[model samples]
Target: MTSYDPQKIIDIHAHLHSDLPSDPALRVKALESLLVEQGLVDPAAIDAWIDLYAEEIGPKRGAHVVARAWTDPAFKAKLLADGTAAIREFDYQGHATGHLIAVENTDTVHNVVVCTLCSCYPFSLLGMSPGWYKAAEYRARVVREPRAVLKEFGVALGEEVEIRVWDSTSELRYLVVPQRPEGTDGLDAAALAALVTRNSMIGTDLLKARA
Candidate 1:
């Protein structure tokens, strides 16, 4: 198995330049430069890949699905019953999403997802996973101290509400359908989708009502 330097990874984020032997970000840049110099990788291609996920294919896909489920009762039922098939109705399918299951947030329950082993995620619908989601701290602490983690993310659930944490794997992925915000009764599907944030879909935050 390949081993990574934990210190380098920590240094990259901590920005402790004084204590570190070398700048982690600069080291990564130098490595990328070397790869480009040797024609082992293409910067443009990498940029294109990042752009495709960040803009073209992103949380908007999941938001559209959520909005559709919210507006259509039959679709919602289908989604709740078989998330994989329901999501396929929109033609959103790709890697790490072999068997999709959607957990819904309600008045009494909330759902969140994480990949303990690695960053196994539904990239097709959710786009790139946030850095925080893949962080070691988040992965280690979320399962054992969910309430505290949620509080750190500014989500304060009531004592009576149930918190469900879904551990995603390469074979089975999960999406959280956040509870619809109040005062959005007259909004159309597109409008409703606009209200859905990436964090809400990740269950780190809730949908806020439009002002």
Candidate 2:
């Protein structure tokens, strides 16, 4: 139950090679070494923090929240009204989720999140931010051309649908509550949670009814 999948983290870090080094791993290693040398960061503390994220907080918590919202009207209302307080019920509050705001997607409206300034994200709930999310291109273009960006992610919306882009900051972050797929009325919370995907929660992919 790692906060994020290791392979995904690797994939995210893989795209970080630019002016530093061709190999991202080497670049990270060098940075860590320098930081350690300057006494700016402790290796053990960093390891502990990584382990905490990898072992405790993750997208599963977000899926659980989504599952409850799908089944409980009251909780869903509360979630949309005050996401920060609603998530505290599960003791899922942590790190970047302290100032969370939940936005729902409907037939006529879609929601997406971006951090135009940096890679700010609800990491405690959504796990680690994806590589593309940290890229300068995404940070710049998502706000200006969200529909086109979403379409590239395989989410095609009709012209009638309004797309809202939320910009996350260090003080506030956004979580998209994707529309629950139809044909899942009989599914329990656990079953429903199993169907939730990180991309859907990020508003990049639309969930389809279970077949």
TM-score of each: 0.79, 0.82
Write down the lDDT of every candidate, Cα atoms only.
Answer: 0.88, 0.89
Give per-residue CA lDDT, model 1, range 1-211, as digits (tens): 5349898777776875564449789877988999999999999999998888767888999999999999999999998888888988888887666688888899999998998999888888888889999999999988889999999999999999999998875588888999989999999999999999988888899888888
- The segments of candidate 2 whose C-alpha lies over 4 angstroms from its true place after superposition are 1-42
Q: Model 2 has how many clashing residue pairs?
A: 0
Name the lDDT value of residue 86 in candidate 2: 94
Give the candidate number with the greatest TM-score.
2
What RMSD, rounded to one decimal, does every model reach?
Answer: 5.0, 8.7
Clashing pairs in 1: none
The regions of model 1 sitting more than 4 angstroms off are 1-47
In model 2, where is the ten-residue run with the lowest total lDDT?
Answer: 11-20
Alpha carbon deviation, residue 17, candidate 1 (Å): 19
